[model samples]
Target: MAYTISDACVSCGACLDSCPVDAIKEGNPYTIEDTCIDCGSCEDTCPAGAISAG
Candidate 1:
């Protein structure tokens, strides 16, 4: 499963820099591509508790 960003995201762009696979985008919730490695790095850095495994 890939990690996803929820509507609670603040779009602060913190998860973008934490993703090792470059899966995160620069939108409201940000986007995680299917190519995601499922690493929790992004989740750990999310301020809004938006990143999760799906």
Candidate 2:
């Protein structure tokens, strides 16, 4: 599965810049790529405990 950002997202825009696939978009909670690498960088950069590897 792809990585998903959850409700804990603070919309800090960290994950948006980190996603290589350009999956993380600016939205209510943001979204991930179905082509995710599961690199967990988004999770690493997230301050709100939002992103998860699926």
Candidate 3:
């Protein structure tokens, strides 16, 4: 499974660089691409707690 970004995301770009595989993309609430490795890096770095296991 991969991580999904929720509406709670603040678009702060906190989870951007945290993605080891560069699966996270910049957007309104940010997005996780299919390349996600499910490492939970983005989720851990999300300040708004918007990322979760999908």
Candidate 4:
């Protein structure tokens, strides 16, 4: 499963650089595209602790 970003996201863009597959998109809270490889990189890089396994 891909990682999901919750409403708690701060739009800090921290997770963007961490996505190896470039599956994260810019948005209010940021979004995980379908190409997400289920890697935990985004989750680990999220400063607001908003990304979770889905």
Error of 4 at 17 (Å): 0.5
lDDT of 3: 0.86
Which stretches of candidate 2 lie above 4 Å from their native place?
none
Position 19, candidate 2: lDDT:
74
TM for every model, in the order presented, reads 0.86, 0.80, 0.91, 0.92
lDDT tens digits by residue: candidate 4, 1-54: 757889999999889898888999999889999999887999998888999997
The collision pairs in model 1 are none
Model 1, global lDDT: 0.84
Best by lDDT: 4
lDDT of 2: 0.81
Of 1 and 3, which scores higher on lDDT? 3
Q: Judged by lDDT against the true structure, how good is candidate 4? A: 0.90
Most accurate candidate by TM-score: 4
- Where does model 4 exceed 4 Å of error? none
Every candidate's lDDT: 0.84, 0.81, 0.86, 0.90
lDDT of 3 by residue, 1-54 (tens): 867899999999889878888888888878888998888988888888899996
Question: For candidate 1, which ten residues in a row score worst on lDDT?
Answer: 27-36
Model 3 residue 19 CA deviation (Å) reads: 0.7
lDDT of candidate 2 over 3-42, digit per residue (tens): 7889888888998788777767788888775677787888
How do the candidates rank by lDDT, highest first? 4, 3, 1, 2
